[model samples]
Target chain A: MTSRRAFLQRSGLIGLGFVAADALATSERLLAAVPGLDPGDPEVPNEEVARILKDLFGDRPIRKGHLTLDMPVVAEDGRIVPVIIESDLPMTPEHYVKAVHLIVDHNPDPHLAAYHLTPAIGSVAIQTRIKMKRTTWVRAIVDTSGGDVWAAYAHVNVSLNGCG
Target chain B: MAIGEARIRIPDRITRGDLITVNAIVMHPMDTGFFRTAEGKPIPAFFIRDVVVTYGGEQVARFEWTSGVSKDPVVSFTLKADKEAPLAITWTDTKGGVYRQTADIAFTAA
Candidate 1:
């Protein structure tokens, strides 16, 4: 066994050399008390995603450039995938955007995540991260004037996402 | 039910004419009611239903959604901006809960 002082330096956890050699045991106990974050599964498909848009914005045409989406081509860790969106329109009281909706197509509840904005916003840009259980697309649905809908999307490959 | 924190990050230096990138993150339980309790019972689904974004108090984006999202949702966007404003995001749940965050950064001029 290493000397008491040496043990502390070896185990980067800090504050233990003074305790009995069972320090390792104590560490386990401390760690166990900490709660873990577990985000559940992602199970959405592209087709279903389209249906969602159609159902939500009835008879509204979704234009192409009102929104833009950015996502990593591949996410090694399923718990966090980067996503971004931006829109071109004055966010003034008279002409600003109304809201931005974010959708992940592989989660158990594929219909997760949404945002609402008022004229307080001068631009239409937002960035966020999400979890993915499998390969999926991050879809953005935007609401413009005359009740028209515009969309943007990005495909992200999740290696093995799920509740941690 | 867990309270979640959402954060936004953006480029400090951006062209006065090009769009800038914005990144955001939220800390949430996204408790999909489908979950089972420790007692092996199904937990009711609870998650964010919609979100909106604004820059300089001007409306920019909005959406409506169901439970197809992963937990602790993170989203990103591109904004064509000038040097005077920041972006803000807000989320709402069907259960009457709200989550919001903001980011102040440089944006290209229109």
Candidate 2:
């Protein structure tokens, strides 16, 4: 009969093996999506968000106009704050909104989400619920495939932090 | 049984030029890995990372999200409908789980 201690030892080793394998597989898929994403780092800091945006958009100034962002001014729970973004920019083959980068200023990972849009949609509007670490500014930066960037910002007051 | 339940909402009928809102919600834990359970074990992070919406075989919205999104996320987007077609919504979690749902849409006059 196998001793209890021996069984525990074998199970512990098997658990470790499974964890290591899972990490390896996850990193491989994440690398393909975010090349610079670090395997050791689970979340990107606020400073990292700025760097990522700068790298993606270059030095172009993102003007705040022609975009509408809707979100409640106050949220009782920061865990599920509804947000909506609408762009008046025309969607055409020559000129269209390429993507929308949603960033929360105070979240542990400020780079909250991103959405890629196409002209086939005939419109550029997206809505999603995001979690906030605290009361912060959620900004949406819209990239118009034509070397122009537009942004819209909304402040959400959270009574309770969500990312703890 | 699947780990999540996904539902997609599309308008019953809309004008050709009208913008219709499509909403999708998936029930998920969205654990951020920063919290420790009562047993002191940190829950592994799990969340839906990619959301793809396709209409009439044309991809419209592609969203990438992380654990920063809330539990049971609600994703809504609008598209101008020129013709009636089927809409496909798919959500891919971090663990390679894919949940997909399709809806047939028909448009009416303005």
Candidate 3:
């Protein structure tokens, strides 16, 4: 354990190592709580969004429509670009939105965030801010409990790099 | 201000079965580790990795985030105000820092 810690420190990933360790433990607990779901790697950064989606969905068809992705056409400050996502999908116990994944195609890490939701949320409405490394396409993908995937995209021109 | 400090907001007036919006903001650097300091030292990645929201003792939403989120993140979502219960938001960061805050959802007669 000490050797691993030392190696992580030397690799400039000491922070990630600590977080990954905790996240792994938590994911294990969550796995038991929610079966048949793969919690993707939270430690790695800059992974391709397509690869991440493929890993999660496994070639499932992602259809377009049924959702709205809103963002500024041009962001003078990429550090905090406001984004809002809403879906017209029903949120009933029989069928609901299982998750919403946010992706930035040009960021160092394209897979920005994922929100796992329940029917108790009443609606598939989300408003958040994100960092953009540069001008990119932001995609919001929704997974429904009924085994359907819907997606929407918005293009944003960023004047500054938010990653720095 | 301390790291992990958070604030939660809910509608002032809620009715039974009303779909209400909940907002939360947490203070953190959300450092991406891709930048460097003036001395050219590489900044390590340090940011919130997980966020959970619970209402009436049940999990309503969970968010997994990467460094792509802006610093001092703000997240908003909608919840069904079916019961008057405590709505809690918790944020856990890369450095083992956990911050939490809760707001009560009081409902009026519809």
Candidate 4:
């Protein structure tokens, strides 16, 4: 005897709850990996990165925008495999790009590189070479207008890992 | 600057659908930690670990690497076709300094 309106409301509540749980899970996962990363450059904790990012913004995670990752799951040549990131969001001076972080999973330590972009960079695009330890996920987290964090994941299959 | 000779090869032109392979090599000593100086001092980590290449002022390729690359670093990638554009290469030192250079890829009948 539940009304359709009541069912819709319940479903909406469930959706909201799921989203909250998902966000929590993502943050936890990020934090969990923070300790093991002895990157040698500097042991940059995930929290410090979060803090830096928060200080830049109003203490909010970047918004998820329309983003695409261009890379193959398996690379024929590990020394250099092609990779690219393309965001569908409009690139303009008024509401333009901020930065892009490259997360290469195959490497012993992730958080491979960061590209600080401006309107002059045009569309916040970046391409780079990353040494893969094994089969790994390459993620591109982009910060754009509205403080959104749009990310795209790419699984790189490497037959010849450049790290070797 | 241990090696002076390097090679760069880019296909004629790139368009939306066309995929082209780009190749580059930089001559340098990829000194891994396995070696030591005459006094047995572990040479500080000095390697080109990061590389960025842009086309037509838009970034087209990038690389993250370590000293494991080899004595000399050679990087190659593929990209879609575009009009006449310049491919810029910037090699980043371990401590984060950049050695910037550019290459022009011309759109010609291939």
Give the best candidate by TM-score: 3
Sorted into a CAPRI-style docking class, model 3 comes out as: medium
Candidate 4 lDDT over B9-61, as tens digits, reads 76545444454666777776655444578998887666777777777888654
Q: Tens-digit lDDT track for model 3 on B20-86?
A: 9999999999999998999999999999999999998899999999998999999999999988899
Query: Which lDDT tens digits does candidate 2 get at residues A1-164?
Result: 99999999999999999999977765455443444333443333344565666676667666678898899899888888888899889998899998988888778778888888888767777878888877777778888889888877788889888887
- Residue A157, candidate 1: Cα error in Å is 1.2
* Error in Å for residue A55 of model 4: 9.7
Residue ranges of candidate 3 with Cα displaced over 4 Å: A1-47
| Model 2 TM-score (B-chain only) | 0.90
Ranking by DockQ: 3, 2, 1, 4
Report the candidate with higher TM-score, 1 versus 4: 1
Number of the top lDDT candidate: 3
Query: What is each predicted model's overall lDDT from 0 to 1?
Result: 0.63, 0.80, 0.85, 0.60
Per-prediction DockQ comes to 0.26, 0.49, 0.64, 0.09
- Order the candidates by lDDT, highest first: 3, 2, 1, 4
Candidate 1 CAPRI grade: acceptable
DockQ (C-alpha) of model 1? 0.26
Error of 1 at A82 (Å): 1.6
Error of 2 at A93 (Å): 2.5
The candidate, 1 or 3, that scores higher on DockQ is 3
Fraction of true contacts retained by every candidate, in order, equals 0.62, 0.81, 0.98, 0.04
